[model samples]
Target: MEFELWYLLLVPVLFGAGWFSRSFDIKEKKSVADETQTLYKGLDLLLDNKKDQALNSLVNLAKIDPDTVELHFALGTLYRKRGDYDRAVKIHNHLYNRADLSKKERARALFSLGQDYLKAGLWDRAEDSFRKTADLESDYKVRAIKELVNIYESEKEWLKAIDEAHILEKVTGETYPSRISHLYCELTLQCMFFKKFDEAAHYLQQAIHADPNNKRALIMQGTMLQKQGKLDEAVEVWKQVGKISPEYETLVVASVADTLLKAGKDADAVRYLESVAEKGINSDSVDAAVDWICKIEGPENALEFLRRYLSQKKSLIGFKRLTDLRLAQDPDNKELKELSDFLKNQIDKTVRYKCNKCGFVTKSFQWQCPGCRNWDSFAPVRSEDPSRI
Candidate 1:
């Protein structure tokens, strides 16, 4: 009878424990459901382009569940995209320092932190983070190396950029010859600035080896040769550039003429200019040829040459040149001077080097587009549309 009484007393205690356990489970499930609802709300807000609200919701969720790695990544990326680099760095740095993060997650976090630093213009910190990230065996390794190349390029560390580019080429099993060639060309220019002719020539050779068709390298080679008193060799090298691309012939015409003039070959210079003009290449070349003709041949011959050239090409710039020549010959002609002024204004407003990728326009050529950060993106010919400018 005593044993039965003890068992009856224990049954109430057991039922009380069971009731508390069931209550705790219900609360835990409710908490999970609320977290899920918050996540969905955040996603909806993001999809609706309410990034501020979405960020708030995600911040709250992160506070509730700090272990959600993917959530932190999303929040960090959103912060970076929104130009909140400090917050983005904080979140990503926290994830990177976490002992519980897997190797891949740590790499991702470090890479993200690098991006934050880069966007914030903290080059040294970004370089450190990306270098460390590149050492890790993860998907971000190649990207980290690429960022390193960009950083070096931006900092004018041409040798370092070339090294990083080579590493990238090896990693991706593809050739970035053109990019590498440009980097070497940059190094060559640096060397040339210090009058290090020997080193400059070596770098030029490397540049050509990297990309034989690099026009900049060829142009630089010609300049270096000219500086070394090899006028004939320089002229020959400049001619090769025209063979590569006839449209690019204008770039070398002035150089060729100057070099020939230095060698007392005035007739040769005039002939070269005339040949370039007869091709009906572009406005700059035609204008150059007309100016040379006026100086060497005479105004009458220049007029005849320009009229025939304009008839063939019908260039606004050529027309402007013709107007200027006419205005010079008849100084008191009010209509001609007015027409010249109008054409000058129109050409100034319309002619620009436009980036093919981003439509960025500039008065001068740029190997890399400032707007889009793309190499070789500028059109070879000047754009004559005011709308593009």
Candidate 2:
């Protein structure tokens, strides 16, 4: 009987505790409503084109609930976009160090921090944050790898750039021959600057292995061999370029001709020129080859060759060469020579190389596009387009 009375008395106390818990639930719901209303107000301000005020309001709201992951990320992204990298880093770093974050959230936070650091020019810190993303098994792995490639490139760390490029190619299944080829070429340049001819040669070989069609590698290889007094070897490598990439022969024709002359193969050089012309050839190459022919054979022969070649395929450069040669042969004709000179200048402007990727125009060739920073973006101008001007 005493036990029953105690049990009956405890029921009202349990009921009172249940009532208090219900009241707390209601208060929690009200708190959620208030946060939602504040978020709506922030959005309203943002929609009014008051971005600074919106950010301030949202940031203040975020301070009230620091565990709101999306809010922090959005704010951090906005800060970074506004060039406030310190605030971006602060927000992202705070999120990155949160022990309550899941694996994916942690990766995302680190990725953001990495971007902030990179934009802030903190290469080492950016690399550290990106490296942390590797262990997270998120898509940030690929993103981090790509950024690391850029970072290494900016820092002139070619070996690390190559390593990261290979990993990226493997992971993303996308070819990076342009980037890899340039990296190897960069290493070759560094080696050659230090008088490390053998190392440069090795890197050139690696570059060719990475991209056999790379024009820079082919030119550098031939140049290196020529510097080492390997005239026949240089001839062979440059001849390979002529055979594979005839359009690029213009860039290396003078070197090949010199090599052939050094190796006592003048006849072979002329024949190579003839062979390159038999295939499709650029006008500059034709101009150069005809000039070479003038020195080797005779001016009459060069004139004959140009006339016959120009008859088959007409071009401004061909006309210019023909006119110049005719003008040189007859200096007494002042009016004819001046007209030819004026035409040559105009044609020279039109014949300038242009970057296919970025439309960056230049008189000389470039292995990389300066405007877009893309490798092999420039191509030889075959014809004039007045519209581009």
TM-score of each: 0.91, 0.77
Model 1 C-alpha lDDT per residue in residues 166-234, reported as the tens digit of each score: 999889998898889999999998998898988989999999999988888888889988988999999
Candidate 1 whole-model C-alpha lDDT, 0 to 1: 0.90
Error of 1 at 35 (Å): 2.3
Q: Which candidate tops lDDT?
A: 1
Error of 1 at 377 (Å): 2.1
The reply for model 1, stretches above 4 Å from the true place, is 1-22
TM-score of 1: 0.91
- What shift in Å separates residue 65 of candidate 1 from its native position after superposition? 1.2
lDDT of each: 0.90, 0.84
TM-score of 2: 0.77
Clashing pairs in 1: none
State the lDDT of candidate 2 residue by residue for 209-261, as single tens digits.
99998878988988988888988888888878767777888888888887897
